[model samples]
Target: MKIAKLSLLFLFLGSFLFAQNQKFTIAEAVNGLRSNLAVKNISQFSWADDGKSYYQSAKNAYMVTDLASHKGDTLVSLYQLNKNLDLDKKLKTFPRITFITKDKGYFTQDSNYFWVERSGKDWKVRDWINIDKEAENIEMLSDNEGFVYTVKNNLYLNRNGKIVAITDDSEENIVNGQAVHQREFGIEKGIFISPDNSKIAFYRMDQTMVGDYPIIDWSVVPAVNKNIKYPMAGTPSHHVTLGVYDIKSNTKRFLNIEGDPEQYLTAITWSPDSKSIFVGVLNRDQNDMKMNQYNALSGNFIKKLFEEQSDKYVEPQHPLLFFPNSNTDFIWQSQRTGYNHLFHYNVDKGLVAQLTKGDWVVTEVLGFNEKKKEIYYVSTQVSPLERHLYKVDWTNFKTQRLAQGVGMHTGILSKDGSQLYDFYSNATTPRVVNVINTNTLKTRNILSAENPLKNYDRPEIKNVTLKADDGTPLYGKIILPTDFDANKKYPVIVYLYNGPHAQLVTDSFPASGNLWYEFMAQKGYIVFTMDGRGSSNRGLKFEQAIFRHAGETEMKDQLQGVAYLKSLPYVDADRLGIHGWSYGGFMTTSFMLKHPDVFKVAVAGGPVIDWNMYEIMYTERYMDSPQNNPEGYKQANLLDKVQNLKGHLLMIHGAQDNVVVWQHSMNFLKAAVDHGVQMDYFVYPGHEHNVLGKDRVHLMQKVTDYFDEYLKK
Candidate 1:
């Protein structure tokens, strides 16, 4: 009897102590992940050229550690870098460094590029170059010979110390050396340097035919109008062409790509010998693609390597990766098998072999091992929610998993593909960085990040899985209120972004998914999130289910989540709330107006009210065109459904948003007024798309206040 009494007393004391722990403030919940509550990590972690050592930035210094001995030494300090550069005011931190060799690296400070070399027990700045302060989209040559940059609407090459004008187009409408196609089709940069460093290929876009749109800056005395070229769906788009500039001859020529001017040119690649270029030419309808090879010097079409066609759409996002030492064969990433897989193609023969095949997709290709004929890549073969590292033999198609973690794993391979630097995180693990020997599968943990929220009164998070109407397994997370009581009912908030190219339910740190969700849970609200069918990383079939009709299938999956939530005895079904941003914002608005009796409150930011007003690249790829699918657009458009809204809806938008545009919300307001419907609206002046930085705390606070006012009441 005495021992049992003592046990009860100790248990009471432990519960009291746990309840006294910290709780996240609105500001902390909004920005703590990047600041006070940030997980400790090895900053700028990279592998050495030899794969025997690795480098990282720490304590304002760059350090390298040997993998065999696990011994570390400081390579360069901020003091040495500042002293070598002769800066008037010392730099506060070490600049980001990229290693070209074991002893040579380069870093940029301000507009100056500094190349450094390892000296005797120290480092010294060997060479440097200064470009214009206004230069954008800078691409440096691999050999450190020169760089290409764009100023305003032209391209310039800085070779050694000489600056040459590569393009001198006068019209701003005809932009040179910049990303085109609204930055779609996996095109991130405009410049591509050849292997031999003798030629440069860049994109030149002419947007004179595109419609001009104005973004107003109300901060000025009399609001200033900034004009931007915007191509709506089924409208004329910017014309893009590839241009090659020969460094030695100082002459430029356009590739002989015969197609519609507005057709997309993606998957740019250079032949190993630097004498040929390959491009994936996609038509404006985005249903057909052709891989064509062209002569580099003469700008002549060599041959059509291959052709891919799809009844829906053939979207090629990755460039063709050539073999290490051969130009006759290359690896192509395609969704031909309903999943993104690797296909080996030869220059003379059509298809050599399929390197990888499965229901899962290869997320990224790290590098190749020439001697062993192997390729390193990241894939979802283990599970759709987790990413793992694997290496495959290109010759025989035998694959082996390298990392032993059940989470999202990303890696950097060494020069010979013998070592892999694996970095990953899971629900319980904040972060872990490991160095693994590919041959032996021996692992060494270099970093194990401590949980940043250990002291906080965190809510109990659980993984929830439900089957869709078509019996597809859908993953979700539910964060119960702090010090949960199963007997008492709780209000629920479903935070979701059920759109393309995004997956919310991942095996990442903080099982609550987002910090803001955890914050709301502490305030006695249950937070839930799920990845619907339209989300990415599944396969072509799962994603294409929402084709032509954007919100129908996704809504079916979300309703399954709703059914699961309502089935729980502790859920207060009448007080449910919803929130999302961008594509998520569209989802939130769609749910509120379509299912008026389900949710009681919603906060949507930067919602796409109409698909016809969106940009051409993304809009047409999924919904075709307004003229092509009028009924689909009419059904998805929120303007006609304004009268059906019965919830406490708060719509937010960035006044100068260029991505979704401010008109999406403004037009919705006009329609609501015309239809005699009432809703709350807010605007963040001088902000774009999403409200970020310190002001984000205010935005989240407003959202939290709305939930507290309506749902809690």
Candidate 2:
């Protein structure tokens, strides 16, 4: 499938000859770009049982496009019929729908749910089910007999014409249905239901012991101070426990796992028979993890099936499937062999058979086909910079590629796993969805391709592998100007967020800053980004190697990255600058303070000056509590080292940023002011953790001007 949209700005030789750094037209840049770009992170697509595809196209409209249709004349509406009951009239706007029911006819919008049924050419609102109070993220059970959902912290079940509240004491201090900040960082929800719909398992986070970070919401008169339970590095985390509730018995039992409640209770799953629940528990230090099975009825500890120990931190995902007809065999992902691999475990025997072993990381688990004995997944096996669809045999650990694409591939499998709608793309390839028959592994339909960046003459971004001082192969991207000249000694802008939880390198389109980078590069400056040490997706040790020394090791890798950049003949070592946001902001601040001479200019947005000021959960996980590791926290604190700041610095933040609280910026502003340090700062009122929409362009302009004034010679 090929999308013929116009690439953003035309690579006009005249534009370059004019010597005017502006090559990419923002209109052409944003025009050919897919609207999906704005909605990609939120939009979801699901394949119907009969193979029809349904997805969200706008804020409230659900589009049903026939993959079999070559013309792409798709049916789009609000997922509901017109108010006047006419098929030709426009559909009424509704609140955004989140999770869709397994039946595909119904979907949940906030707390209310409605079903659509086809009546000839018109779609009718078949049923509107309200489970009372404001609910969120609702989904029907696999049995289709009831629904499981979350309302704030409470879990609910609506079945047999009644709404059942599964959890009662779901207050601010005691959370049951929702995931914590860590889960948000990990990008996974914290609730699941048993296949039979008889049992529901959820993560209950006890934040009563956690520290409350104050975020003053200034929109209100006199400023209303809101206490948000945010656990930062070196602080006590929220106590977490797993609980199972049985609907028939009206009983709730907490699992009998022994450990610090403040630790992480992650990757919860149920056995196929619904008789037992499996959990992956990682220690607070995250160096050790244990996989245990618990008896669902008695809430008794069945056994510790497996244990994975790492010198660094351990990351656990949802434990793999335990096929119903088979024994307690599951697939678990581990980086014990230095590369992430899948291991098939026999729980009863306590034996783990390595399933998929190689030098690649399983990017994500798509699904498991029990009947076909195939484990479908997306992996970086193709290349570290790209993802591909692959299927592995459950019995033999043999793997086969399902999609042939030299880019990132994400797939949605059919209900029966017989077909898949595969989405593939790269820096150059706009997103294209292709329907394929998984059984025959043949492309059935070329569906939709949307390119939002078609008209922009975007600069070419090339993925490069640079070795760290320790010989760790680090992946990064070099973004250059459209009129780049190797003969010129260009200033270098090092974009970094070398933290443990995030990765920056992917086969995706460059950011809007590519234009800014292009402008800088045209002005004889080079822009680069690297996924340094402590960045995720490699494995436990590679990431947690920064443990207890959060900023130290990350800085080493980034410094190595800077040295690598210096090796380029066109790069000017004396004209290096760095910028980052949040943890990246913390990195920027720490780097600028610790090695002031290395950077000419720096920008830190929403930085954490001191770990002691951070919340309890996240801070303690990495640095332990200040009461325990005052020295580690002190060493990582940017405030103490600010005295060494000799570089030009710019601090930017959102006034309403609850995550890093504006005080993080305010504190640094005060410290820098007291020290008589020259600094520039900006704040976006009414903005939260991020600046978006039209403000983004203005922010970009501000960034360009600041960097140009400070770093450009």
**TM-score for each of the candidates:** 0.96, 0.85
Candidate 2: residue 629 Cα off by (Å): 5.0
lDDT of each: 0.91, 0.72
User: How much RMSD separates candidate 1 from the native structure?
Assistant: 2.8
The C-alpha stretches of model 1 lying farther than 4 A from their native spots are 1-20, 82-92
Give candidate 1's TM-score: 0.96
Error of 1 at 330 (Å): 1.0
lDDT of 1 at 403: 85
For 578-625, candidate 1 gives per-residue lDDT tens digits of 999998999999999888898999999999999999999898888888
lDDT of 2 by residue, 1-713 (tens): 12323332344555654544335433223322333333133256666566555454555566555655633333435544564355653345653443344223665544456666556566566456767666665667776666777777778888855888888883668877777655532527667788777888887878886777676777778888778787766656678788888889888988898987766777777888888888777787766888888898888998898888865446565565664366577777777887777777787876567877777788787776667888888887877777899888878877889887577798988766767778877776656667777778888545445554444445666677877777889988787755677787878888888886677888765442344555555555678988888887776557766777778888888877888788889788999999898889999999888888899998887787787776654676677667777778779877656678888988889887877778877888788878887778899877888877767666666777788898996
Best by lDDT: 1
Clashing pairs in 1: none
